[model samples]
Target: MRAALPGARTRPSARARRERTAGLAFISPWIFGFLVFTAWPILYSGYLSLTDYDVLTDPSFVGLDNYERMVGDPQVRLALWNTLQYTLLQVPLYVLVALALALLLHQAGRASGFFRTAFFVPKMTPPVAVGVLLLLLFNGEYGLVNEALGAVGIDGPSWTTDPDWIRPGLALVSLWSVGAAVVILLAALQDVPVELYDAARVDGAGWWRRTRTVTIPMISGALFFVTVVNTIAAFQMFTEAYSAYFGAGNSTYSNDAALFYVIYLFREGFAELHMGYASALAWLLFVVIMLVTAVQLLVSRRLVYYEGEQR
Candidate 1:
């Protein structure tokens, strides 16, 4: 190694500078888009949350008034409760369905690819279409669901008309698009070491015991990811519920059971033109999601297993 002068500083060669410039040029579009479309909008919404703005007039500063109003709003409580119920009902069922599908496909050998694709096809369907499909399948009288129940000598509840069945019906409908989680979990399952299963088998572990002791722990990270993502999605549920119960032609159906947080936020912002209050609602949701995610992270430290992580 050659000794360098004490005061000398190294400079990038021409090639290095050119490569850096090229890299920056390649990412500039994404940087610009993030600033304009994502970052700016989030900052602006935060500012709007503290103001009183209806689209027609300029935003008037309101400090904590909007948030205070939320504290007293019965509809806010109702919406939050509905969302919580939906999250609790849907997330576990969704994970179980996705995991079941993933496990079945994992054993499918050469046919796994075909089955995986088939399962994922529904996930590509538009939310609006899914909402319409929900109405059709769960219609009070002539729907396919009730028809199938009738075949088994069971009576199906009026899913659309009855408020009591609405949340459960929506939760059931949400399972139709668990493909992404299935794919994630399937990938995680594939990554688990064959040696682990082999060891369990050698110890006379049965299928269920081996799965409980080996398979689940190996994929806990993926399970954690799916749970967090699904929870957030549940909280933000809007388009499907809106289209099913609140859309122009669907207004005849009962909406109280399906009045999710984001649907209420959408109604306040777009329908009633209470943009400021909607922004506050959005912020509150953001804070809640952040807190919930933080708690999940804390819990995951104990529950989630990572390969090569320090014990």
Candidate 2:
């Protein structure tokens, strides 16, 4: 105590040095792979967006032209409309469904685990397989959906064929895979303080009032987070719509009902080999998403109630 033992500040601990070195060594592969595969392409895509690269002709530097074309393209208009529609409708519907399912599964019950697994099964199935199955289920003639409707003495509309219903049919397929969000919400619901419920009960708060005042405010952050994420996912939907209608670019709809934003961009980039234009469109989509996300963040600050703050 009199000498005040050297505070070990001068020594580099062997374990600390070894751990740092080992971590760098372990993640070197990932760093290298990211640089080669992901980072380079993203950088190059920004460069390519300013050129007219069609693979057949030499990439001529035409800055902003591809972007201009995308701005004026009618297909872009329809694609944006479809993308916005899917996002606005499906995200909210699935978010509400997930919340309701979470509440149901979180109740004082024994079969909750089984219900969770059942809900999650659809999410684990491959998207392509889901698309193929939806084709069979939503098929206009001799399909399971219409067959069941016929048995109930109600006529079913041509879901896949009707221009008005094709997008909704696709939405129905996407809505089936709300399992991940449901699971997340269920976990959040479980995290909510049980004492709050007890307090509410003591104050004579009924189920609806308790949910509205307690469950909703506490879970608002999770709900908003899920909405933003699902909105992004819905905006990027391509495989189901593409497989259902544009496997060969020969759909018979008078207006391209299934012409989703990413599908249109994919056709421009890979199918038509218009890499430059697709890059431009990709950048535009990125900007749009950024703006939307910023708005959500700003708006969420008003609605999303975090714990420990007085609502």
Candidate 3:
């Protein structure tokens, strides 16, 4: 070969080119699936949001009417308010419960593995099943939860029927699936240096003091991750609320309390066949989640601590 000129780029060798082609071929299926299933649907949904389609007819462009309708829609406002209340009630409670369980497991030492598995089994329960269980457990009169409360001479509210208590009941139900967060937090706890605890103890720090000053800051990254994940999940809550209150033959409960945003979206799209309107609702949810996550990330910079990160 002639000597290469300055700044001249060299072509890949035959072997390198073949390897590159093979790598692309190997990942082609995933790339195709993502494009068809994820990317296309997302783009199409954005387009659909600007149209009026009832699934039976071709879409007619409606500009921003669907979005505008949401501004004055009582059901949309109620659903959004319900979803917001549930999320606010659920996220902090869920995080605290998960953290408490993680701390307990951390102290369990030899029994941690068994307890971890037991706790995680609930997370594997289907959401529909969990919803059914929620009804049974919080039935107000004869439910096990009320029965337990009665043992201490306290009466429990009708969780499924009472509007005031419905969101709290849903929040309590959310705590049942805290196992994944517990596992994550436990892993983070394990990674925390023992020397930190020892140093704190040497400084006469009590358990709570050490946890507040040393433990929390060290595991702040994991705490932040758990909060963010749970926040998103809470905002998107659907199956459990739907199965519990919005399902066919379930008219006894107060639906307004459980009419979460996703449940309304599902009803609009599939039940009522307002596909375009549902698409608009879906896009609004996407924007809300993105904004909320951005806020969390911005706040986390001041809270979360990472190893080797400069103060």
Candidate 4:
């Protein structure tokens, strides 16, 4: 049976080798783009974080000055708090809503394509439009939201006003464009083997158990991916806040209610021309995101079960 043919297993056919080469060659462009655009800036920013680089002047060595200021700067602390608040409040809301939507579409067993497209429509909308729409919806004076509240015998607060309600406004704005997340979770749900659900049912497991024992484990990777990605987005929240309240360069619109870490970094970096401080802000964000992700990974290992891993 061995070596029956002279050239058996001698070489991959020309087309097969070409296909492999072509695949690698095709992806090389993306690899180049990532290194040039992403890797360079990250490395550059880290270097700048250690120096005072005002665009007007050559970068002056500042050795830990930016980091020290970041620790003491009141606005830095405030921005960090705001970013964390966004992560805690919005990530859960977005991920849970996405999961719920994914599960609903998954269980519908019909019209899934329709529901998926419907849910994904929001992500396609321009962020500017979303900000304007939310502004109109949550506006206090003669806005649709206040009008609705008035009809229900309640008055809505001035959304862009009222420090206490500002975060809520941000969170509300966060929910509008979660279509990307929904699409992701939907894909994950699609891969959940239906046989597991049937087996759980046959074993007298209730809905909760089905989710815990079947759905969650199977989709845990997607969950982690969405969580980390959403957390990073939340930490970098700027568009909603900037467009709605603090446009181009009028400073922060309100009592810095919408002051996010990235927004602050932008102001400190470009507007105020504190390049070193802004770089410090960026690096602090990197550290915080890393720490938060590490913590989540640690905790998730306890709860995020992967399929076939013994409980």
- Quote model 1's TM-score: 0.93
Per-candidate Cα lDDT values, in order, are 0.94, 0.87, 0.94, 0.82
lDDT of 4 by residue, 1-311 (tens): 45648656666889999999999999999989999999999998888889988889989888998988877789987887877776788888888988888888887777988878887887878777776776778877877878988999997898767766777777877777777888898888888888999999999999999998889888988998898888888888887777777765435347477788898999999999988778888888888888988988898887675767788
Ten residues in sequence with the least summed lDDT for candidate 4: 247-256
Q: Which ten residues in a row have the lowest lDDT in candidate 2?
A: 246-255
Winner on lDDT between 2 and 3 is 3
State how far residue 115 of model 1 sits from its true place (Å): 0.6
For model 2, residues 68-135, the per-residue Cα lDDT tens digits are 89878999999999888878778878898899999999993778889998999889888877777777
Per candidate, the number of residue pairs that clash is: 0, 0, 0, 0
Candidate 3 worst ten-residue window by lDDT? 246-255
Screening candidate 3 with a backbone cut-off below 3 angstroms (N, C-alpha, C), the clashing residue pairs are none
**Which of the two, 1 or 4, has more TM-score?**
1
TM-score for predicted model 2 compared with the true structure: 0.87
| Residue pairs of candidate 4 with colliding backbone atoms | none
Clashing pairs in 1: none
The root-mean-square deviation over C-alpha atoms between each candidate and the true structure, in angstroms, is 2.5, 3.8, 2.5, 4.5
What is the per-residue lDDT of model 3 for residues 148-248, given as tens digits with 9 covering 90 to 100? 99999998899999999999998999888999999999999999999999998999999999999998999999999999989999999999989999888
lDDT of 1 at 169: 91
Screening candidate 2 with a backbone cut-off below 3 angstroms (N, C-alpha, C), the clashing residue pairs are none
List the candidate 4 regions with Cα displacement exceeding 4 Å: 1-26, 248-253, 308-311
- Cα RMSD (Å) between model 4 and the true structure? 4.5
